[model samples]
Target: MQTINCPRLIERVMANTLESIMISDRRGRIIKVNNAFTRITGYSESEALGQTPAMLRSERHPPSFYAAMRAEIDHRGSWSGEVWNRRKTGEIYLQWLSINALEDEKGYVSHYVAISHDLSELRAREAEVEFLAFNDPLTRLGNRQLLMNRLDQALASCREKGEVLGLMVLDVGRLRPINDHFGMRAGDEVICTQAERLHLLAEASDTLVRLQGDTFALLRHSQASVADMTHLAERIIKDLSRGITLQDKSLLMRPSLGIALFPQDAMNKENLIQAAESAQMQAKSQGRKMFRFFDHGQHSEQQRQLIIEHDLGELIIARKHTGLELYYQPKMCLVSQTVCGAEALLRWQHPSLGWISPGEFIPVAEQTHLCVRLDRWVIKQALQQIKSWQQQGVDVPSIAVNLSAHQLDQEDFASWLASEVAHEGLNPSVIQLEITEGAMIRNGEAAVALLEQLQGQGFSISLDDFGTGYSSLSYLDSLPLNELKIDRSFLQRIDRDERSLKLLRAIAGLALSLDLQVVVEGVETDRQVALLSQFGHIKVQGFYFYRPLPAAEFRELLDLQ
Candidate 1:
């Protein structure tokens, strides 16, 4: 049977199709033109018949572009693409084009035909869609898809270059409070501000991508060293640590970072991302405002995490094993030099570790989603204790109960506080909620909104560890904060360091100006107490007055006072 030939059909389609079609000699000069060519170029057959298609080149592409394109066609005998071309009216339009070589008889002589369709409108629409798809609405940074695409490209480039590509992934610490407690509008401000902060921290060559929610991805072509990565991460942490004043409220920053290096920790794109993510999980597990690197012994770390997770779950729910105890430290009145109030701090008496510091177990509980229960328990216990003190006619000033960023992120924490107060038959204002300044800033918008909500409900908020953070005073002015507790470090140095006294004076002065109550923590001696007196009307808590005592011992101390 004779084979059916297709070249004749190709010729007919190229010569008469709707798409602009042209025939050229082997040298690429136009030898013939179709009707659609005249229609698209706004030139009659006479004007385009012999003119080369290059005459329609819009100059958007470089000269070398056409040269390389021609070379490809010469070597392969065909080319197809979307290229910009100019109409006779001088308007630049995009064209979807296809070209093929035609040969006859001995297959030694040749001609080429090109078919093109207008694609300008399609391209414009695609661009608009692409923008929406690849960017975060609030931050205007690359979203997850864009970040992954870039990571893929960076991995490919790293493989080609035989160099290490560093990936720095950051999770804004304490950001959940802003989004969960405050409305999303307030949370948007935090996210937007973070983008600006990251832009300044990342090198010019690095790509900064916002990876959905509070996560960000940074890709560097080459890392100078581990120190350089750490320096960059620190810059990000410090910049974001600055107070965020939104509307009438303010917030602080807290973040955690993880890093993975290409060709070192991982070579493939998936492995690189997994390593970075694993490191991030480790950072989050440690606490916010921390950085960690990928460890090859990921399985062991995972096993450790599993054990901690198991213990945390059991600790929160299993009251039989959980040695939940409340500790009290007296807060002294600066002028009177006597105990005016006390901070109710939580301590876990681990049957194994003897005393598990709040620092360790709190973070573990928060990450494992056990903090909600633990925080609720602490609040209830504190409120009940305060109510009991009041019932005994102890008439103590408000008892301060510290709150965690994770606790504020809980949807019902504020209302839960209200219920706890009502349950204990105590005034909401009698229990002041203390949160770290670092938590406030990192959670900027969310924390501020939550503060206002909790404040509006008659609960008091205190800026804990005031001067040690970026700016607790600024947040105090914006948030409905009732007190500013000077960090223990500042007070410890007060007697020996004049600078600290002056600094404490400045903070106290600012607190007075803003009508905020001032409290100095960790005052250990008569000399420290005398030095702190210069600050005026400040409340003090330290071993100099009394160490953190258990409930029974604290109640006895309360009777004595």
Candidate 2:
């Protein structure tokens, strides 16, 4: 400290610093520059000497900008701010520049010292942050934030012009299963492919956004008519329906679209998005590649569903099963002309809503974790009821319980069912598992494997609601099915429609040839029953014999039989 070289230390510090340092005389001619200045401006110290800072000026700043900077420096004796500067290579870059004036003993400016830090990296980082905030990382499409901003602007413009705005929310079906089966990379490929296809369908005025996983929104900035919206929806569905090839394997995508109109369906951005989402839910429920328009009636139904979902969650959290009941609908074998088995149907009686049908609440449950809990509850109650009936000498041969797709997704479902049956001291064959084709299709090979595991454990597996799904015949031989329950739609006109009757006969015969038991559902009239009776060795289940009844009533009926 005693022998510190002050001037040498200052020069070393300035040379070592990363910031570009420059010095100019009172006449504004370059006098000195540090190494960083040469690195930043691509100029040698010899070439820069005697030159004014105007050599580094960029066209980005107007003449007024330079005048203001000069005024600030003259008034304050210093200036510091961001400046656009040009390099010797003619490349423009941003820099944070600070200049300080040095005065002599006479109190007049004699020299100026300037320090500059390149802002290219900082500016790039800021730009990247801004882009990510408004775009989906995977698809590089506008995200929900950008969508909201554009939607607000569009809505304001539409209100002023007295024009309608159409908002379409689209969902890609079965994407979750794809992600579960194949890896997430496959899922990303599918999402990118769909986004490209949707972008291709978009017009220049339209705004396409990726709201979240497997969901996209399209804002119809032009031609917001009902017919135009419908046509766009149709084109989207058809285009997405074509199989996307991933690693030489073709993956099919079914897109469902929901259209909601501004001013008619919703007046605000949030409400409009919700309306479109609700309509999309409806479209998915109706079928794949389908589109639905928003209606007040559907909105009311959606509100009720929300209430039901909330109440169901409360019941689940409280572990309250008193409101949940299982009704038994008897399945009679035509060959024996007696009650052979009964189906356990779930019913809920909400304290506030009075009675909620399965048709109304089941779909809602399927969308949440409530479905798995509900399925387990149904199985446990059915098993306990069967033991109670047997103890009372009610000779109910077998009981069928419907399983949700969520239940099939559980890895331990088969083992859990086996343990439950064994705990009740009942043969596994006494319990039949009724599964919808849609459930099997959703779970893919996993469902088939689960069914085979259950069958191996002596549990009977019946394919429920057949002929209404996509691949019934293709699955007949592969699925470990003991019975096929023909859907009621096939029998709605069986009494008068000869083609339906013949088709029903063909299905029954097909099941018979495969040595599988056949069950015909929805035989409402004696004529339908009489026509179905012609098929040998089949079971009939519908209101024609008996509607679903409470357990006590069902036990009494079994006792009478």
**Best model number under lDDT:** 2
Q: C-alpha displacement of 90 in model 1, angstroms?
A: 78
Model 2 Cα lDDT, one tens digit per residue, 1-561: 589999899799888999999999999999999889999999999989999999999999999998998899899999999999999999999999999999999999999999999998899999989999999989999999999999989999999999999999997777898889888998988899899999999997999999988999999964599999999999999998899877788877888999999889999999999999989988998886899998779789779878998998887767887698999999999878899999999999988788899998888888776889888888999999889878877776889999999899899998898899999999998899999998998899999999999999999999999988784586789899999999999999776789988988998999999999999998888788878888999999999999999988888888787
lDDT of 1 at 334: 70
Cα lDDT tens digits for candidate 1, 1-561: 978669877768766778888888877778777777888888777887667887898999999988887888778878888898999999999998888888878885488978889897788889878896987767777777877788788777767777678888887766678877777887777888888889877778887888878889888876436778878877877787788876677777778888888788886778877788888888888767777888879745575556656776786788543677888887778777566777888886655556767776777887777877877777778877788778878766777888777777777777777887888787787888889888787777888888889999998788888767687345766787888888888876776888877887887888888888888777778788777776777788877878888878877876775
C-alpha RMSD (angstroms) for model 2 = 8.4
Could you give me the TM-score of model 1 versus the true structure? 0.46
Candidate 2: list runs displaced more than 4 Å: 105-108, 171-190, 238-253, 281-290, 295-310, 321-347, 358-561
Ten-residue segment with the worst summed lDDT in candidate 2?
467-476
